[model samples]
Target chain A: MFKNFFPNKILSLSNNLLNSLLVYLILVMFLGLIYSLYISPPDYIQGDSVRIMYVHVPSSFISLACFGIIGIASILNLVFKIKFIPLMSKSLAPVGCTFTLISIVTGSLWGKPTWGTWWAWDARLTSMVILLLFYFGYIFVWKFVSSFNKANKISSIIAIIGLLNLPVIKYSVDWWNTLHQPSSITLTSAPTIHYSMLIPLIIMLAGMIIYLLIIFLMKYKTETIKFKMNKIKNKK
Target chain B: MLGKNAKKRAILLTLLLLLSAVTIFLIFKSLEENIVYFFTPSEIYNKQNISFNKTIRVGGLVKENSISKEQNSVKFIITDFKNEIIVSYSGLIPNLFSEGKGVIAEGELKDKKYFIAEKILAKHDENYMPPEVTKALEKSNK
Candidate 1:
């Protein structure tokens, strides 16, 4: 079962899948952008500024999702002692970091027009900043550690620790009196947002997921190639 | 078969993770009061000891038809429905500030029913809809 997760297997499969993924990504992102920017109606209360949700919400969601993937992969690597698992998490870190940064920046831009302040020390906002710091710590561990096995061990520990922050970030708004409002869409209940707005949001979210897949595959490919090169050099 | 060393490492790692999680939970639990961004009108009223001079935030809905504007100053009532606070401020309110909308006032408490706000921020709810939908909803409500 785990043999399918091997680096060589995944690398070969990803090479073939990458082109189709790119085509779908471009098409989805194009449609997503048009729908979010024009086709969707402007918010009644927020007016045009509400359009920022198209980018901000999706970015935040992707960032959280990327971290989740890293955390789970780290756990599996630790338990099963899989050599290639660390590579997957390592490739995912930069993508997660980039999305976290995007979420914070877009959120700040949205905050100014909507929340009447550029930043607040509210629970929801503070937890997100903490998440970005965790991402930074995880990436830095891989960069600074000289030995591959040592780096993998240390980074896995960091990711597992960082996993603790995920729930705090998700429930921060509900658990505290936050300037940020509670989530409008939840899996357990009907979304409060109108379909006209929700449709574009879903499209944008899909586009973002595809975009993440593309970036992850590219990074994973590069890392695998480097691993192969290093292995050949070691044998020689 | 899994090595005994790997089994020991796994157990140790699990302990470490659990210990840290408990520590974090305790820390957050201790800091609960400090973590709240603002107090509701009722919360302020319920508090036994609240400093009059210390600046704090009070958040709630702006009561309907309670706004009064004058040169360089404005007055409105902030209510959580159960309790209400009369807020007085002299500042440029945010664009979303209006009657019967969510708002937060950060300032000093003058008394039980009065507050002197230094800055006012508008708080929008989670609901999002187009202008036409909002208009239709308003009409239906009326």
Candidate 2:
């Protein structure tokens, strides 16, 4: 029982945590480069230009995943009505926004080489732009509303409703044929990606997911601590 | 005062959360299975296909001596250094697309090597050069 409470237990575990995490980061980066450049066989068709999937697909996954967190945090706040819940949701906004921003920025970068144009009004692209706007509105709601309870009130509504755009983004291509190409790998269909390419992609995405988790945990811990400290100070 | 504020806030927050959860669940359920990637011609020949399954991209160079406006389709010779491929695009080619420029058309693969292009991607221009080219040039000089 005493051992469970010891500082050594927690301290020692966390000591090498940073080092092991560093190794994981380097390993993922190396694998990502290797898979895209070497391991992955070129598309029998698109050839090397197909390598953008390594970056684009994973970033899009992260974008979707980040917003999922917002939905969960919002639900927890409602059920528990915990003060901490809203505070955590508030802290999550910037991170989710950052992921969404990366998705759009990289998509634009990849567009120049592939699509031959910097921008398009294509349905998928347009819905994504709307998603970006929703993110801005979500952040704005939190920033402008001074009262914590009131801010939580408004932000929760926006986050839930904003989700309407996610489906629009997905179906935009199927709903209407546009410049954006149709999805290649499907749930029932075999993946069109070659193994050499697929392995590295999976590795890179795993690294990104882990990296996001580490940051989210760190952020949550810091926020919780600050909240506690503020509470104590008020009492004093 | 505190009790009223807390209760009212809780009620509003609950309704919003329930609606949002259902909506987000719908989004997750709707995630697409297939993903697409784009490519350039030279990269296709040199690297092979980069996607997982059957790869797709436009293949051709501007067909020399063949390019002319026949109604909507512009005919051209898409050539590598060795062999030439023929292409017909009905829609507008970007201003950058012209004779002598390398291009890769995207669409279905017809027969053995023929590509029936649905979209045209006109290749490089004076304003653009692959970063790899400069790096490779520098490395060679070194």
Candidate 1, residues B1-142, lDDT tens digits: the string is 7688778777887898899999999999999888899999999999998899998999999999999999999999999999999999998888889988889899999997999999888888999999999889989999
Residue-level lDDT tens digits of model 2 in A154-210: 787676666666666766657643456556555787775545566877888887776
- lDDT by residue (B24-54, candidate 2, tens digit) is 6566457422221233344444544344234
- What lDDT score belongs to each candidate, Candidate 1 first? 0.90, 0.62
TM-score of chain A of each: 0.95, 0.83
Interface RMSD of each: 1.4, 10.9
What TM-score results for chain B in every one of the models?
0.90, 0.46
DockQ: which candidate is best?
1
DockQ of candidate 2 against the true complex: 0.07
TM-score of each: 0.94, 0.61
